[model samples]
Target: MQTELTLNERHLYLHRYPTRQNETLQAWDAGDEYLINHVEQLGLPPAQNIVIINDSFGALSCYLSKHHNVTMVSDSFIAHQGAKANLSRNQCVAITHLNTLNELPSDTDLVLLKIPKSNRHLSWILDKIRNTLPANCRVVSVNKVREIHTSTLKLFEKHLGTTTTSLAWKKHRLVFSQLDASPQPISPFVEWSVDGENYSLKNLPNVYSGESLDLGARFLLPYLPKDERFKRIIDLGCGNGVLSVKLGQLNPNAEIIGVDESYMAVESATLNVKAALGPEFQFEAKVNNCLDDFAPQSADLIVCNPPFHQQLAVTDHIAWQMFCDAKQVLRAKGKLLVIGNRHLGYDNKLARLFGKAQLRQIAVNKKFVILQATK
Candidate 1:
């Protein structure tokens, strides 16, 4: 997979963000190729303010940065890292980076966007574009032809103004839109209250388990390991930091850290944590992949509601990595608790990572299993 990808007469190498696993996933997709090809074929000139949304890696940015001033904006922290890694590997100049939902630059004219899996996410991006872009600005969005639908076109028309599509090329289609300076529109972020948790969780369009408290996490909450009081804790895949907020409130002496791969998740979790712990508490939320940078045996307890997939593919590599990293960061006799779907078969994986692991049947619900492993 490490080979030259020629786009717009330029060559570059790209990889998906690091998985720390053996998944053979390509970094870029046909949509990426289609968008670049469209601009080139149309004789579009490069400009100083080129904004790219969700360029999974640096493929688009690296190739375009040669002439255009590029700014990379995404929600995934891993994508940002991958873009930077590939940029350095290609010896390309560093590009500006911004997390999703951030303020769009005042000089933005040409926008390159990739359609996300979530309609909510796409809606938010479109909302941001509508609020920021100048009249007559051009936005080029692409996706696999299979993903394009009437609703997709409606989003473009509703948010950005007039829109049209190019004929399918290589099973991908490019969307062309011009800013219409339409009336300001609003898209609301979703909010839900956990039934018994006394917490209202806010979900950004792209955060995991956005519709509600994930069933596994909800099931595991009542059974949270309370065998002993812990002073240092980590919430591994803390979706909205609800677990940490609750944990912080319950354990007065504990200092907590919540980490997620998505910057939007971390931001949502941080807000929840603040509302729960106030300003004087010792807790922080950060965007990180597993426990990559944590020192060995630094946590007294680790809690996780691990993710089973990355991007479009469903896989358990992320869960496996999280379990292994939890063991590395847990103090001697420190505990790691995770909630997962019953069919995932995480017990054996945890046993392989830790010397021993136990499965707890904490509920009558047959859909989920809570696994606890110790270092």
Candidate 2:
């Protein structure tokens, strides 16, 4: 179903994609509407330089585009694509310039943001805004009413400035804030120790499978190919480049590449790769959507720990996309290795994509299984 959203005195019909296998889930939520409503009430200045962060769909961007000059920031390639598609559908001129977390534009008069579900990523964005914007820049952060509280305010206070939540509207809340009179230097990325490893891991807020290693990833570690004879290796959906570090260790000479949709994840992975492998490690990690830009028949081996969700809804489209993209990028006789829950039926996906899929290992009593597919 499509939603006709009226915001900033303009009405737009935004197309929200349904969650995979769950047709009932809509692409957007009340939080998005609340942000738009709050902006409309502000009677925001014309041609004002406004920035919006974490807009899940085009709802917020499409509305703002009609009146104010806007800049949109998000980490998901799919979300960005959805926003553009919706803009075209509505016959709306793109008002806000869209950018990823890795490339934030400079100072602006106002910032309208939807609180991302990942607290880690939110904190990073807060810190980034604090560091880049002037001391008096205004920021409005909107979220569901149930998500606001003292701790939430404290998080904003810690980096940007004193923050207060507005009264609830339709079970949603907006945070009013300004850059603190004296903002500290951007805090370092949050750091955590990887168990059984000497090197500490660091992360930006939105990176996937953060801090502690993912359960499925942990199970897939030992099964990694023990030899380093492969020519080209990719850590598909590489979060913080952990698997790349391991893959590098296993095949010291093979060229490794890690890719993810989150800018923070790519930054963290780049740092971790250098720290873990010393200056000798040869690899590239960048912000991308499942190798969307990779050339076909290029990679000789691919490793993946595909994500099961995008934002709050669970889905396997990302996994399916990863598998499909891997096939396009893998050379003839190349292989793709993945670890996932047994119930996800990834074995079938692999079989269909590669024509040959085999279970390499399984952890008894655990849902994780490692599978290999060859082209």
Candidate 3:
């Protein structure tokens, strides 16, 4: 994959966060390039306070920060780390990095957005902009032409203001919206109870399966390994901490930890776990890239519902990396329990990582499978 981004006679070396030696994907896509090129052509005055939302890896900030004060907003911890690394690698000016939960800067003159895959997330961001930022701020967004639809544009118009789209370039398109909409109350957190369980889960806007229990998780719930011998349990990619909460109930003495990349996901998980297990429960929800910072052989049990995609890109690299990390962190004879769609072929991947003899199918349905691998 290309690491150098050449725009306007300038070159910036960029990489995705937790840079992998065999990474096949580039840090930025055509949509990112389209947005950067369009902004450069506009020749916005220097010193303008610019807010860049959902930048995958700081491509927009790395380019614009040289001339303008930039505030990078994202819901991803990994994306923020990537942006920071790329900024340092390119020797770009230091720019502000803000999580999605933070209020948009009121002084922002321009907003550059990379439309997220989740419309709920997009609506949440647009709501923040409408409620906090000035109505005159120009919001320019970019996405693959195939991803944007009439419904997507309607979201922009409904939450922010009048919106328009540019002609497709390189299979990508730009959306322009004027922030003229009246401020509306932000949506409330989604709350739901697990089937046959009294525990209630509260999900922030960007949390995975926010509206209900994920189907895979629902399938895996009956198979979750419960043992008092599990001293340190991890819920990898824990969305709303439902699995962590369940594990806590089964093995009350085990310390449960939830790890996810999204800031909103981690926050929601933290809240849900606390609400379910009480404030004194031994639980921790962390925003991280898989288990990159985890100590080797520190976990006794790791339960995962691996995601097949990151942002809008459908890929298996993340699931692969999570499996590898689980192998590194699990103690001797410790187990990693994973649930995923059958077509993802996680069984073959786990067999390769943990050896065929160490992996076994715990349960399987028509659509999903729960596999357990022993370290």
Q: Taking the tens digit of each residue's C-alpha lDDT, what string does model 1 give over 1-375?
A: 445687656778777667334547787878888877776776766665889998988788888888788999999887888899889989998799998868888688689999898888888888888887787567999988999999999988887888999899889998988888474566455888987977788878888888788877778778765534697999998988878877887776788999998987988888777776787888888889789999998999899888888877687888888888888899998888888887888877887777553444344457887777777
Query: Which runs in model 3 stand beyond 4 Å of their true positions?
Result: none
TM accuracy, model 2: 0.86
lDDT of each: 0.82, 0.77, 0.91
Candidate 1 worst ten-residue window by lDDT: 355-364
Summarize candidate 3's per-residue lDDT along 118-144 as a digit string, tens digits: 888888998998889887888999988
Candidate 2 local lDDT, residue 119: 65
Error of 2 at 125 (Å): 2.6
- How many clashing residue pairs, candidate 1? 0
The best-first sequence of candidates by lDDT reads 3, 1, 2
Q: TM-score rank, highest first?
A: 3, 1, 2
* Count of backbone clashes, every candidate in sequence: 0, 5, 0
CA RMSD of all predictions: 2.0, 3.1, 1.5
Which segments of model 1 are wrong by more than 4 Å?
19-22, 357-364
